[model samples]
Target chain A: MAINKIVASVEEAVADVHDGAVILVGGFGNIWNAPSYLLTAISKLPVKNLTVVSNSGGFGIEIWGGVFGVHEHDVEVLHRTKQCTKHIVSAPTNPLVVNTLETRYRAGEVEVEMCAQGTLAERVRAGRAGLGGILTPTGVGIPEIQRDKPVIEIDDRKYLVEKAIKGDFALIRAHKADRWGNLVYKGTSRTFNATMAGAARVTIAEVDEIVELGELDPEAIVTPGIYVNRVVLRQ
Target chain B: MTEKFRIDDQTMALRVAKEFKDGDVVNLGIGVPTLASNFIPGDREVIFHAENGVLGYGNICTAGEGSYDLLNAGGQPVEPRPGMSILDHAESFCVIRGGWLDWTVLGGLQVSEKGDLANWMVPEKKIGTIGGAMDLAFGAKKVIVVMPHNTKNGGYKIVKECTYPITGFRCVDLVVTDIAVIEVTPEGMVLKEVAPTWTPEEVQQLTEPRLIIAPDLHEIELA
Candidate 1:
């Protein structure tokens, strides 16, 4: 049988997500790179107590209104609707405005595990590559970040051991994808989307355009179809 | 005392920009450090790296210009430059953690005499984001911190030790503030230059740690 990973709708794409699922939402805190449709579908679901791993906690849809002139939802929708209970993130708070994650965290409504940005990326990559963990120099000597984590010395330098983080679902945004789910991204939109492509049990891609198989240049594919489980088109 | 002469943010950034050498791969953290990209010497070639997967980007775009997809570390839209390459977050940080960056200019809340940097969080809030600061602070070949010399209420930011959570240990090489330019050295924090009309003694008054005045201490020069 031929492989067909395309899903019918955004809601159907996320239908099997259970309560307390771990989700990896891709984006660098901007609408351009965010899987807004997928996140919105998840937000409308009754799923609760979710774990979200992303770069930023999100600036909410309202924050992007000034730039895009259209209010588009981001990962913040998950926090705003109270679907996510825990967030593993690098940058959680915006310096200019107090986002939903900050408000929820301050009020003790949610939990946050802060990791360095590079360390977060490596952790996700480790999950995809099936590594046990990564020894990084990022949080070494910082008491807050180091807090009880094992430290290993190599070549006369101290490194911290950070465990891998694998998610049950990865919601990613890409510029284009083929029927086989071969992906290509544009500009900086590739940030965490490409990194989290295969770092989950189910990797769902929300692309701006879908093309026929063999349409995507063989040499230019950023993500192979084998890493992706499903593809959805933007509405 | 009369209002002490202090340079503006742009001038401080210009002074910091003068430190960039030709062919330097530099990363600019958010805020004032982001302004350094606008002031790099015209004759020099400096590649700007953003933590959000863009490298060799040109400058912050004006209103109604540039794509939202192309942004700096500050999330501001930027112009695409020739020879620009976009990578995923993993490879973008590989460039950072692999020690490919020559210099990284970051904003600081407090910098210790030992070059400890604490800029990510405010202790009073009990919640702050680390972002990519830790890796940038530890991974860059040299780290430069740029901020005002003191807090809004006249509190010392350049201190003997950081009270807030630190971003990295012994990583800062230079600090450019509105009132002075100080270099971190084995001996201590060295007061290299002061804002025009401001004395080293005046700068030290706002700093928590005692400064070792440079032998050739002079007024800050932007040109």
Candidate 2:
């Protein structure tokens, strides 16, 4: 039988995600580009002890107004449902307010690995590229960011070694996709989604619209179909 | 209410914007630094770099005119200029980590006399987030802190030493606050400009580090 990438629903898309899974949610800038349908579907399923990686730690009640409604992203909903075991993120705040992650962290209910926003992005990209790691000077002298990481000096300049971060599954969002799984992102919603397309064992995309093959302009394609294992059209 | 010889946010931003040279590339932090873009003079074409990925965005977008898709690093929707380009997270950080920023204006909780920045977290708060603070502080050619002279609880922010977690060590070059503009030099904090109504001695009382008054100390003017 020929492989068909399209899935019936968000629940079916995330159905294979087991407990203790490491999920990387793509997109930044609130939930405008986040895979909200996939996130909401995951929130309803019986999963726990998950490790979530993203740009910000997650969203809170504050940023519920965007392209999507107030259902919340997988990161925030995972924390709310006590399903997340840890988070490796750059900005962990809920933007303007204290969030469940903060409370859970303080209460020792979850673990967090704080990283620089850029380093976080690069590390994820490195994972997708199959590189060993990234050497950056951004967090050289800072103690908290260094976190006992190795610092090597090249040409008398110092750089910290940050390992690549791959995930079991990468949840991404795209503005448009062709039946072949070619993706095109719109505006700033293309933040981390493009880099995360091929960085995981399984890459799933929740797109606003899916067009017929040959409909998307070849030059506008951001993520090719080979990287994506499944495609779910947003309900 | 009695006059406190204090400046508003816009005035503070104006003072900081004057520091940028023509054709400089700058990264503005979330709060007070966000206002500096509005005060950049028309004659000087300073490029504003938002970490989330727009290179040449001009100003904050009014609510009715913007979609959630065109936002700055602060997550506020903004308008892109004539030469704006969008990049992904990896490429955006390449701009930051490559030392392309000529000036980075950041807000601080405390700045030590030794130029250590403690801005990402409050000690009492159990959970805190350090977004791009470390990266900007480490890679920018010059880091200028823009914040209030004192905490909301009336404690001095420029201290001999910081009690909270440090963001970057000896990275701050200048600090623009509500009451005064100070520079972090090898010797100590140099008092450069003050509010018109405040005296040097009065500003000293609010500051914790010993002030080295500059020979050309003058009042801050916003034009």
Q: What is the C-alpha DockQ of each candidate?
A: 0.91, 0.72
Off by over 4 Å in 2: A1-4, A61-74, B1-3
Determine which window of 10 residues in candidate 2 chain A has minimal summed lDDT: A65-74
- Residue-level lDDT of model 1, residues A59-78, one tens digit each, is 88877787567577988889
Error of 2 at A222 (Å): 2.3
Which residue pairs in candidate 1 have backbone atoms (N, alpha carbon, C) closer than 3 angstroms, thus clashing? none
How would the docking of model 2 be graded?
medium
User: In candidate 2, what are the lDDT values of residues B41-88, reduced to their tens digit?
Assistant: 667788998777778778787766776788887777887778788888
Q: Best lDDT goes to which candidate?
A: 1
Error of 2 at A138 (Å): 2.7
- Please give each candidate's TM-score: 0.98, 0.94
User: For model 2, what is the error of residue A66's alpha carbon versus the real structure, in angstroms, after optimal superposition?
Assistant: 11
What lDDT would each prediction earn against the true structure? 0.91, 0.85
Question: What fraction of native interface contacts is shared by candidate 2?
Answer: 0.78
Off by over 4 Å in 1: none
Q: Share of real interface contacts recovered by each model?
A: 0.97, 0.78
